[model samples]
Target: MESTEVLRISRLARIDLDQDEGARFADQLTKILAYFEKLQEVDTGGVSPASHPTDLVAPVRADRPDGWEAPRDLVARSDGHTDEFYRVPRVLE
Candidate 1:
C-alpha cells in the first residue's frame, strides 16, 4: 500500500495521521494484504465454507411465558406504582 492510499483511508476513517504514522500504516497494510493473497493460493477443493466449525445446532426452548408473580411488598414500596405496574413518564408527545 502506498502512503497516499493510507492517507486517503485515514481521511475516510476520520483519523488524523502524521507523515511518519501514514508511512508506518502503509507498510503494515501492505503486509496484511500480502498475507491475504498467500491465503488465497491454498487449495481447498473438498472443504465447505462454514460460519462455525462444529455441526451442532443450538437448542431452542418454547417462547411461552412462565406463570410468575411479583411480591406485593415490592410493589407497595414504589411511589409511582399502580398495583404491580410502575408509572413511568410518557416518552412520546
Candidate 2:
C-alpha cells in the first residue's frame, strides 16, 4: 500500500493519521500483503476447506428416562400458553 492510498483509506474509515503514521501503516500493509502473496503460491489442490484446523467431533450423550412433568409445570406458570405453543403478540406489521 502506498502512503497516499493508506491516507485515503484512513480518511474513509474516519481514522486520523499524519503523513508519518500513514507511511508506517503503508509499510506494514505492504508486508502483510506480501505474506498473503507468498501463501497464494502454495499448492493445496487436494486440501479441503475447513472451518477449523483441527479434527473435532461432538460427544455422544447417553439417553436416560425423564418425565414430561417439568415442561407441563413451566407452561402452567407462564403468562402465555396454548395447547401446543406459546402465544406472542405480533412484533411487525
Candidate 3:
C-alpha cells in the first residue's frame, strides 16, 4: 500500500504518523500481510494442540504463606489523590 493508504488507516485508527515513518510502516505492513497470505496455503495435517513447542515440565516448589501487609495509612501520603485513582496530566496531549 502507499503512504496515502497508511495515512487513511492512521486517521481511522486515531493515530498520528509522520510522512517518512508512515511510508516505512506501509512497506513493512505490506510484507507482513504477504507472509500471512502465504500462511493461508498451509495444511495442518496431524499436529497436536500445544501451549509450548517442547515437552519439558517445570519443577514443583512448596507453597508458602505471604507474611507482608500494606501500610495502614492508605491516602495519607497522596498529593493529587482521588477516591481510589491518582490523576495526572495526559501524556499524549
Candidate 4:
C-alpha cells in the first residue's frame, strides 16, 4: 500500500501504528498475498477426500441397575413448589 493509504487506514480504523509497525505489517501482508498467488500454480489430480486418516473403534460403557424415581414424585419431594417452577426465598432489596 502507498504511505498515504496506510496512514488513512490506521486513522479510519482508530488504530495507532507507529512507522515501523505500519511498514512491517504492510510488508508481511504483501508477502502473504504473494504466497496465495503462487498457490495458483499447483495441479491436484485424482485425490480422494477422507474425513479421517485411520480406523476408529467405538467405546462401550458398563450398564448398572440404579432405581429411577418418577418425575411427579421428584416434583412432590421439593419444598411446596409446582412442577413448572421451583420455590426460592424472595431476593428483593
Candidate 5:
C-alpha cells in the first residue's frame, strides 16, 4: 500500500490523517495485505469450511406457551380502571 492509496482510503472513510499517519498506515496495511497473500498460498484440499471450530451442539429448550394471569387486584386499586381495563384521559376530540 502506498501513502497516496492510504490517503484516498482515509478520504473515503471520512477520516483526517496527517502525512506521518498516512505513511504509517500505508506500511501497516502493506504488511497486513502481505500476510493475506501468504495465507492464500496454503493448500487446503481436504479441509472443509466450518462455522465453529468445535463440534459441540448447543442445548435447545422445548418451546411451550405459558399462560399469563392478569393482576386483577392492581386494576381494582386504580381509580381510572373499570372491570379489567385501565381508562386513560382522551387525547384527541
Candidate 6:
C-alpha cells in the first residue's frame, strides 16, 4: 500500500485520489486484503458452489386444454382482425 502504488492504481482505474484520499484508500485496501487472506484459510472442501444457498425446486402445474375463445363482439370492435387473430403493423424489419 505504498503511496506510489496507490497513485498508480488510482490512475489505472481512472479515479482521482488526492494525497489524503490515497493514504486512506491504502489503509482500507490493506485491511480488505487481510480479510480476503483470512477467508482463504477457511475450510470449504465439501461445500458446493450455487447461485443460491438453499436447495430449491420449481413447482410444476398440470396442463390441460381449455376451450377459451374471444367473443365476436370484441373482435368486431377492433381496427383490424383476421379469423383467428387481431392484426397490427409489423414492429421490426
Q: Which model scores highest in TM-score?
A: 1
**Model 2 Cα RMSD, Å?**
10.0
- Output the better candidate (1/3) by TM-score: 1
Error of 2 at 92 (Å): 30
Q: How accurate is candidate 4 locally (lDDT)?
A: 0.77
> For model 3, what is the error of residue 51's alpha carbon versus the real structure, in angstroms, after optimal superposition?
14
Ten contiguous residues minimizing lDDT sum, candidate 5: 65-74
TM-score of each: 0.45, 0.41, 0.44, 0.33, 0.43, 0.43
Candidate 3 clashes: the total is: 0
In each prediction, how many residue pairs overlap at the backbone (N, C-alpha, C within less than 3 A)? 0, 0, 0, 0, 0, 0
Superior by TM-score: candidate 3 or candidate 5: 3
lDDT of 6 by residue, 1-93 (tens): 677888888889999998789899999988887877987788989987797767778677889777767566587689998865788999999
For model 3, residues 1-93, the per-residue Cα lDDT tens digits are 777889899999999998788989999989988888986577877967799888999887879876655433465456765655665777996
Q: For model 5, how does the per-residue alpha-carbon lDDT over 1-93 read when each residue is reduced to its tens digit?
A: 988889888989999998788888999999999988987788988989899989999988889877667677778888798888888899999
- Give the lowest summed-lDDT range of ten residues in model 1: 67-76
Candidate 3's TM-score reads 0.44
Candidate lDDT values, in order: 0.86, 0.83, 0.79, 0.77, 0.87, 0.83
- Return the TM-score for candidate 5, rounded to 2 decimals: 0.43
Residue 1, model 2, lDDT: 89
Which TM-score value belongs to model 1? 0.45
Q: Give the number of the best model, judged by lDDT.
A: 5
Estimate, for each residue in 35-81, the C-alpha lDDT of model 2 and write its tens digit.
Answer: 88987788989988898777888677779876686776677667788
RMSD of 4: 12.6
Candidate 2 TM-score over all chains jointly: 0.41
**Against the hidden true structure, what lDDT does model 3 obtain?**
0.79
